[model samples]
Target: MTRGLTPSVHAIWQAMGLVPPPGPLGARHDFTIEDTDLILRLAPDGQAATLEGTLGALTPDPHEATAQLRKLLRLGLGLAGFNRAALVLPDVNGADAAGAAALMALADRRPDQPPLRVTAQARIAPGDPRAAVAALEDILQWRSFARDVIPASAEPATAAAHPASPATPPDSGADFVIFQP
Candidate 1:
């Protein structure tokens, strides 16, 4: 709960009970939680950091992809009360792009392989190591919910074949009512 002072990524890692990677400033470190891959990049000044991870791949169907993207956008905007993490669409070149543009790029590049990956990012503020840990949890929660929204495979039959299966509820644990369309 400290404020006003910048903390090094090493300090944050220690606060989270993690071993700090041996690296200089602006280095990137990778970590995995429950099979989900996450990357943390320390700022040049070592005062701030950005934690990013892929939530899931977008469905190949354009219509479904668009819908999924819109839902993520809404969630990233804090409409679902999840504001700690920001969802983004990164192009194959690793440049940040809008959801629609990224989808189009993915379609042009490799329709067979889902190139459009929805990523979640959270900025670790200076002096708040706990916030960094919270950000990681938030991103992981978003990943779980996003996987349910965006199918892992492009085949529609896969979803149709299991239409009877109930969707996995999000693990937010909050008592907010969820609306289904």
Candidate 2:
């Protein structure tokens, strides 16, 4: 059998049959312009692919659901006119070659901008729709001027009740991890 080439941006592009050269990696993550969507994929050692979601459809509100989404999410999604923009948050705790490339892609797209930093506070209110609504408010309150605020909701009893389930714990202190997709 023939030997396979290593996974580089060029190789990935060739694999995708794209003619244009891939851009250098940016602050958020290295992304290649494919059609209308910006794609960032990572397969780091000792770490799962933490960021692997897409931004698309260029909607007034691109969220799959309103309650679970953060209010400031629009800021990130709407920053560019395109319907889809994806950034993969690399696991920087260890080796980050792939992560670095991804970040570089983000930087390329958002030059001179901070790499999508985010901070959030969530509260669980049982049997109260308002709790979810409040969570959105909290996201806006805690959000930095540069970053977008994302409002979320959750149910106290059901694990999935929280509209914004599967959040990266505060302890992780992850700036932004794939936009809660």
TM-scores of the candidates in the order shown: 0.60, 0.21
Q: Which residue window of length 10 is worst by lDDT in model 2?
A: 150-159
Task: Report the lDDT tens digits of candidate 1 across residue range 81-104.
Answer: 755777766653545455456566
Give the residue spans of candidate 1 off by over 4 A: 1-26, 44-46, 78-82, 91-102, 106-114, 151-181
- Per-residue alpha-carbon lDDT of model 2 for 1-181, expressed as tens digits? 0011112333434545666244444322334232122223232331111122222211112222232234435554553343222222445554656444434544344323222322232332333333333333333323322222222111111212345646667787678747665
- Each prediction's Cα lDDT score? 0.64, 0.32
What is candidate 1's CA lDDT for residue 3? Answer: 22
> 98, model 1: CA deviation in Å?
13
